[model samples]
Target: MMTRAYIFLNGVGEKEEFYKKLDFKNSSVYCADGGYRQCLKAGAIPKEVWGDFDSVSDSEFKDLEDSDIILRKFSKEKDSTDGELLIEYVSSKNYDEIYVLCGLGGRLDHELTNINLLFKYKNINIKTEKELLFSVDRKYTFINKKNKIISFVPFSDEVRNMNLKGFKYPLNDYLLKRGDSRCMSNIVCSDEATVDFNTGRLLCILND
Candidate 1:
């Protein structure tokens, strides 16, 4: 299945690297409100635009309409955030892989909500500004953080078979607690890292 890339403009930051990382040719791009400007700045035209006009100026909205991009405007009174709305749009399209840019480095609350959304859409490959968060079925996730540090946090009763390779504190068939930092600050000994859990939900954090 083709991967879909969504860009949300909370407040602009770097763009060149993000554009380079994304396979724009094979991916569908969605811009949320002010994100439209970011996409344009990156020389990408979004396939669809979503958000209330609160964040985007009138002229910008006109520019998007003039450019023929599909726009889905929502009301400010809605319960969902613009990022969440865009996510819903992508989910309905059945895209298995999703890369989100500009969702981080913004408001703290918004960033937290975006992170929580990872759990909401557990089946899709979701990449954010600072990390890649995705779940394998309802049990496991392969996370790549930004600084070569990996952390394993259990969200269920217990996570067994918790083998971790390429780390300072390597484990074999270990059990993790719901609230523990034993799995934190581990390093990757190899180029590729691996984590396996027997049962329960686990959040595997890996730093790149």
Candidate 2:
């Protein structure tokens, strides 16, 4: 199945690169409020625009009104953040997989909240200018690329009975907990790697 790409105009760095790699024709595009500007800058067309319209400029809003895209506005004092609202919109459409762009590296609070908020959705990952990442709450297997550094962080206080295979520092029935630096940087040594944990969640990140 195909998935849509969600763009957030949070003014993250290296925006041009994100647009260069985006496939506009194959995926549905949704802009988070002011994200429409980034979408325009990236030379992408938007299918939908959503937000409180606070960050979106009057000129931009006027421009969008002249277009065929659907605009969904919310209150500034809404319970969920704009990012969360974007997710809610797409979720209602039954879009299972979404690639989020420019959701990192702007305001520290917004950056972190965007990342944490998406941890529960499967096949949904935030694609920052630097790297692509997703949260894992279960066993996961990855193809090993020699010398490629893959990082894993305990999403909770501790992860018990963690096992790793086909890695430089493979773990077996190990306990990986918070504040433990041992699992910070690990490289794949073989053709594949496996990670399984009994409890807690994992925030796995790979170098882009």
Candidate that scores best on lDDT: 2
Per-candidate total of colliding backbone pairs: 3, 0
Give the runs in model 2 whose Cα sits over 4 Å from its true position.
9-11, 92-96
RMSD of each: 3.6, 1.9
Model 1's alpha-carbon lDDT is: 0.69
lDDT of 1 by residue, 93-139 (tens): 77666766676666888876776676676444445445555543333
Q: Please list all clashing residue pairs in model 2, or write none if there are none.
A: none
The candidate maximizing TM-score is 2
Over the stretch 28-108, how does candidate 2's per-residue lDDT look in tens digits?
A: 888887677777777778888888888888988998888889988888998887777886667667665677777777689
Question: What C-alpha lDDT do the candidate models reach, one value each?
Answer: 0.69, 0.77
Per-residue error (Å), model 1, residue 79: 1.9
